[model samples]
Target: MAASLIGRHFFIQSRNRRTLTLKSRLKYSSAVQAVSNEDVESLYPPVKPRFPPGNWTSMTEEEAWTRYEAMQEMTAVPTVKERLEKLTKKQMRAYRFPVNNKSVRVLEFQKNVTKSHLIKGLPTVYDSLQVDSLILEKIKPYIIEVLLLEKERLFRSRFRDIHRDSLILRNLIQTLLPLLYEHNTALRTSQVDEEVDIKGFWDRSGFKRVMWYDPEMERPKEFRIKYANDVRFQTAHVCDVSIRTENPLKEFLPIDDELCINEEFPVLEYHPKVFGTSKTDREKSQLTPGYNLGDPCEFGLVSFHNTVWLDYQRRKYGDAVTEEMRQGMGLTASFTWLLAQAYSQGFNSLLDVTYPMTTQTVLSDGQKMSFFAYQLNTIDMLKNNMANPRQNICWYTDETQLYEKIEDGKVIGFNDETCETLLKFLLMKPERRNINMKPTLPAESSDILSETEFISRNPLDLSTETN
Candidate 1:
């Protein structure tokens, strides 16, 4: 064993010496020297094979195929799970908009071609309607009647719960009003600064009719579908343009002229049971203070409980649901559509000039209230105008509950989240630069049946279809 070990050590030493001698000889040899290919190949070669194997001459076809197969397995793309993990990690590190309140959640954030976050909600009602908007002219009176009846019912009910903790009403003043105004930056910031004359509007009996379509002689055929079998094609619609007018006398009742505290809006002597006690006498005129361009001629509190909201929550979170907990689920469609139409067609007339066409709807039922505001911006929906049908709005909406803390008949802890949200809504003014509304032909132009023209053209026809 000792002899064998000595022999192995001597062999290693001899190999090292030979390697050193070979390296020195290769380094010092003349470039012109003709060394045999076999001898040259014996020098220290590559530590490992090349990545793509060899040139065509060095690698056989079978060997190349084998290498390709091995590489295919090793360098395969990531699986779905692996990719998702990587994406999740990257997203977690990215900055996100801080949402302090758990109750308020942003469900969607859509961007348009300009990459602006002016997301318009779905137009559900508009798509379903086949008849021309002129139908609104006929049903205007009926709609007013129904709404007034509903309002009277709500007021007569005089539920104590609604007045004290009215979520719907609170949402209107705080959320909706600001949202609508801010959407059109001009109105939101009072940039136009146009002095509006309300004397005429106040003098009138408060019954006014505004035409949605222009009075033209030529009519365009806009029949959606004239099939006899489909009754859905003949349906007309009533928009939310007709809202209730305000009567200070009915609203601020119990406090007559003698007992009225505020001369401007007539404040009640004592807080009414139905409308609740005002935190201060200042509240009468303090609702939506900055909207000076147009007066709220059609302002009225409404009570509408949304059952759809309750059902949705019940399914989503298995939470306690109530009928009063109404959600304005599908109303967004009408709100967006009407506002777009108004801005595109009522720019000068229906906006704030002739009469304050601005309308406000506040619905409260459950523990919350939602608000919607409509203001006309531009009325150039005709062929010769820059009428935009997309994202051209100056409206506001909110669902945050109003009072945060109440103690001893006074709100002690006001909700910071709610207040902040309202402030944020106010801060968002509509910018003309951001308005990407393109010129689209008016939907009403499809029919040239103005009230006057339709009547003159078919004087003998007294049927509902003719006129």
Candidate 2:
């Protein structure tokens, strides 16, 4: 039994030894394993080179710099000093007022004259001046018949329906002017200037702004900008249509018209725009009345404003708003136009005009019409200049209905009074101003008007000879 046990032990020991040896052999084989042709081909593709360096240059510093200078000469690069000068000499900024804007409130407010916080009243002109008997009797009936005939023809036309107010106004002018022009010398000689650009800078107690980049200074506690975006600003108005006459209208009031020069009046503190935020502030400066002084038709006889632009106002606020909007339009259009004329004559916000200028204005929207007569008394409304006692004058009439509607070739509610008033406006003759009308232009006139020729000509003379 002992012998058998010893033999079994020896057999088990030998079996364990063989198992350990086999495990060691497998580990050694893995470490020294031979690579096959397939492994060699697939282990990894040969690594591709990237961003290879180019050959180094052997040029000296002087040679490199010379080459650079030559390239710069080819490109014509500016000098450092020239660049610095360009940076230092800042360009003048230009701000502009929109002629027609998206918002009625904005347009009305921007173009508002009465609410400008400027001087209000001047010597009032007699609006109820007697009309000539010839116009009242024979001319009135003829115009009425012509108007009726014209209305009938416009309504029956298939191509143009004449639904828009602008179209109606255009037609009215075309039909009426031709008839009146024959009888009226002023209307015949006076040419129409359409959409003439006028621009200038004047302070009607307008709010001031510090240049955005300017440093704060000791200012009045009340020195606040009218708008957040209100910067150095100016006025630029486009005269839609102006009747340019050969001679200026006679001054409505005598220069020595009695006035308590120190009479005080309340001023309107009104904001020009309702918009809360804006960034544009730079303003463009212009001083032209649509015509140079030497222009034969330099005098403005009448101004026509298209109230059809107020179509949006009527739709939003109802027809009642038309009167209020037009009243402001009449004031604004007349005021700006006269200012432009004054500016062109070398009068500015600082320098007042030597004589007053009278202009007639007609506002229409095809069916409705209103009339105004403006006499520009002063443009010097600056705070310091307000002591000058003269105030501007305006005479205006309410909107008159031309016709209600057209039905089946018969005109509905055709008004004769409106037609007569229109004829009166067209037939209104302009008399030459007996006074030295414009500022005393220098010998070398920017107006192209020779001082000698201007002074030598009689002030009452209607005939104007152009250079």
Q: Give TM per candidate.
A: 0.24, 0.60
What lDDT tens digits, residue by residue, belong to model 2 across residues 1-467?
A: 54456457768988999999998888777567675675455567776433223211333344335444433442242332222233224433433344333344442354333223222322243345445656556554444454455555655433323243434454456556666666777888878766667654454444444443312423323432222222223455665567788888777666556531323434434544443223343323444577655667777887776765666667777766554666666776777777777765555554567787878888775567888777777775543224455666666787788778767755678687776676666666788766555434443333345223644654576877999
Clash counts per candidate, in order, are 19, 5
Candidate 1 per-residue lDDT over residues 186-210, each given as its tens digit = 3332321111111100000111222
Error of 1 at 113 (Å): 24
Q: Look at candidate 2 and tell me the lDDT of residue 2.
A: 42
lDDT of each: 0.28, 0.56
Give the clash count for model 2. 5
